[model samples]
Target: MSLVNRRRRPPAINIVPLVDVLTVLLFFFLVTMQFKQVSVLNITVPKIETAGKNEIKEQILIAVSAEGEFFYNDRPVDKEQLEGLVQLAGDTTPDMPVLLIADEDAPLKHVTLVMDLCRSHRLNKLRLQSR
Candidate 1:
């Protein structure tokens, strides 16, 4: 065969693996990261026999202390105020998720009162927090 000059193409950098790794990292961070709601009250959340991971995003944090005091988003509120706040939130965002943080020693009636108010205001997206 006659000797001929052959042109060689430059090596291409593959980006598929890098894209895959970035996608996996993004998913890992998104799945593990959650919104942490800080409460001013020292209410002990009740414990459950199940997992502690929550899939629902809490927009309104309603805390009930062992003494049956209500707190709305870390701010102390009375029963009437709580109802008004819930009503306003429900009117603004009907599907807003509400997280109830009640002390383990809190009475069942107190917890149910908050639940009843939420339901009355059409804010049924409620989830109970646990220790």
Candidate 2:
């Protein structure tokens, strides 16, 4: 009998498992992804007796305290810079509403001044503070 040498063959490649795992990962990411962007501010507004729930689109909250202090979304701002700040905020979202939240004891002149500024800027949506 003649002696013969036996050679081992290499293993076959399998791509199906790899493709399945990749597809699963893709689906997981898509399902868990969020598409919305949210912006927020922290400020205390006065409560009003006649306050009603109103639908607010995009808003730049202007806060005024009883001490005649002015704030842009909880951040203190210089009274002289009110116009500039309002312009900047309006620029962020051109058509967004302006919400003015003044404390019950806040000076009326402050609120009126803010409203006048908004009107001058042609920002039509204006909401006033109450209660």
Candidate 3:
């Protein structure tokens, strides 16, 4: 009998398919992710025993900081600028709701001032947000 020697080849791993799958997963996550716009200021809203959710299609958001500073749509503004923004919003939408998101430590006077502004502008649909 003749002596015969055979060399066995190692199996090859294809990385192209793995890379394609990872890329697809990455894109899927990016496409389905929901990003929320967060404010820079630290705000802790007060909790209430009785609070209901009111969803309005079109509304303006006003944030009042603990220091009584005003922010319209996340941008800082003075009283005059706030008034102008409110007026513009009212002109665009007659009965658009105004949502007031005030910090828990904010003074009552600040809240009252915002309410007064809304009342003066005839923005009757006003809602206060709390935790």
Candidate 4:
């Protein structure tokens, strides 16, 4: 009987499929990611006894200074302009949440005025921010 010798092939791993899956995951995360813009206002929010976490995604930020000034998204806005902005937001997205961040020393009148504006515009999802 003649003995035959066979050559053994080295073990190999297929990486093409792994690379495709990684590429798909990267694209998925990049497409569905949400970016938040940081607020530049120096607001000293008041402390609260019980404050729940705010999980609303789309929100309009209104800042009230201690001196009774109003700011929308960090930009100064007068009473009428603030009302117009609230109205526009209500007309566009009625259910959109409004976040009021007032300074600890801010007057109650300013806060009430913003609340009134929101109520008049029918934007009922109002969240007051506190420390």
TM-score winner = 3
Per-residue lDDT for 1-131 in model 2, tens only?
Answer: 33456565899989999999999999999999996523243334677688887667557778877788888776788777888987776666567788888877778898888888877776768898554
Q: lDDT of all predictions, in order shown? A: 0.89, 0.76, 0.86, 0.90
Q: How far is each candidate from the true structure, as Cα RMSD in Å?
A: 7.6, 7.2, 4.0, 6.6
Error of 1 at 3 (Å): 73
Off by over 4 Å in 4: 1-37
Give the CA lDDT, 0 to 100, for residue 115 in model 4. 94
TM-score of each model, paired residue for residue: 0.69, 0.58, 0.74, 0.69
lDDT of 1 by residue, 1-131 (tens): 43466666899999999999999999999999995755569988877989477777547889999999999998999999999999999898988989889999999999999999998888888889886
Residues 44-99, candidate 4, lDDT per residue (tens digit)? 89889899877877789999999989999789999889999999999988888899
Distance (Å) between predicted and true CA of 16, model 2? 35
> In candidate 1, where is summed lDDT lowest over 10 consecutive residues?
1-10
Q: How many residue pairs clash in each candidate at the backbone level?
A: 0, 2, 0, 0
Best by lDDT: 4
- Which residue pairs clash within candidate 2? 47-131, 48-131
